[model samples]
Target: MEEAAAWLAALDAGSATREEFEAWRAVDSRRAVAFAQVADAFEQIERLRTVHDPLPEPRRLGPVRLNRRNLLRGGVVAGGIAIAGGFAMQAAAREHAETGVGERRTVVLEDGTRVSLNTDTRISWRIKGETRSLWLDQGEIALNVRALAGPPLRLSANGMRFDLEPGAFNARREPETVALLVLKGTASAENRAVRVGALAQAIGRDISVHPAEAVAIDRARSWQNGQLVFEGESLDFVVAEFNRYLDDKLVVADPRLSRIRLGGRFTNTDPTELLKALDASFGIRAKRGESGAIMLSAS
Candidate 1:
């Protein structure tokens, strides 16, 4: 599990090359199993965080590192929340909201800030005098700040705080990564600021900011339309995404099939349709086991 987490973190940090991933996966079948287990565990964290959104007391002055493995074991089942992945932020929150699996909800806070909680998302927020602050515990949220004469809206995620300049933007927090996509106005990730049509990804301790053009912006916000857009994503990555909205998880049984690249758009509501599409296009076969898990293999 540690190795799996290391590989995932390396990939998230953009430090792992394709050859490294391939070589690591080629060593043993158990490595693949470990990777799958770790992936599924994080997916569960994505959903379970909504159900168990607990805020721990503020740590001492130094930076607090949230261990993903410990978070998976302790927080998910025991309702203990850890920020995980060595990101530091203010811990206490004034209010919290969450959405269950396969659910999306729009919430209007006291300050009239409309927050759209995507599937299995949780957030902690506070509206103080002249300052609106929030923390993204897990999943994604689209914040449409009201144009009232109030404080600037601020959000904390993955150990960094963002001051959102009035407008609309989306932020997503995963186990080891945080992404900020500006849709309308401006928002600052750490010290780096982004205006309209910008995408910033914070992985580990590094941040990558890119201009979000029309196509990328549309794809990023496609979840609002009940669709998921992918371009040249791996089979494993695609399956991991499809597992988010699925009750029965999808597993790629053949390790050799993990790296096959796929592209296109698909409905996020139905996993079976995606499986069928994969079968038709990539000649992959899906089988159901008695344990209620769906396994995909080369036909």
Candidate 2:
């Protein structure tokens, strides 16, 4: 050990440099392994210094519970694969069970209620007698709360609570701001009950609840039945919803293009067909995004 310490001192003092270390490393792979160990130690220490103690774990509830929590639509979203800390996530190492990029997941809950998780989604839920409760922390998810004689089912997400009445439907989340879209069923957005044909949107410090003449249900299950239901919608609204199920998001560069009315039934996974229909029927050109998302601007 004394001789090893002396050697290190000599190296630090310019008697030896990285050239000497590389020569040593090359002679026996052990030297290279030793250097890597040192580097790893340094990196771990730096990471520990950067992160505070309290970091929440990624949450997941899988296909385990039959009537309690279920991953719908023949989609098996494996449990949340979390990294301990201090490194970027490797693409291959990450495991996610999700609907397609813009697709939907229609899962049948244990109590006969149905849930449709929107694109880029994850959820944790547990069923308790008399009162059904779940957490929708991130992503877009819809719920069709079965008509239960028991207490109302509660959904909490984005700092808001959704009291799903019997035969009520709702989709809401808070990432940047709180947004709730209610159609067919009733959902409590913010504090008010939003019924069929209503859309309520909320952001931090601001909430808006109004009775609208129209509603939009961006459901993944509807496509299985060969329907893309759009209710009193604009061109951009339909395009964006289409992007969620299709691999590409539509890019609407023109501001005015957003206002045109859009109502149609189109097949899922066929954005090109939808665009062609739009062009043929509406005379709008659809440009292609880098990843093939159709972008519609004024032609």
> Whole-model Cα lDDT per candidate?
0.71, 0.55
Candidate 1 regions with alpha-carbon error over 4 angstroms = 1-93, 213-215
**Cα-based lDDT at residue 152, candidate 1:** 65
Clashing pairs in 1: 66-84, 88-159, 130-151
Q: What is the lDDT of residue 210 in candidate 1?
A: 92
lDDT score at residue 101, model 1, on the 0-100 scale? 62
How big is the positional error of residue 50 in model 2, measured in Å on the Cα after superposition? 24
Which candidate achieves the best TM-score against the true structure?
A: 1
User: How well does model 2 score by local distance difference test?
Assistant: 0.55
Among residues 3 or more apart in sequence or in different chains, the pairs in candidate 2 whose N, CA or C atoms overlap within 3 Å are 67-110, 72-107, 102-244, 102-245, 168-186, 169-185, 251-295
After best superposition, candidate 1 residue 67: deviation in angstroms? Answer: 20
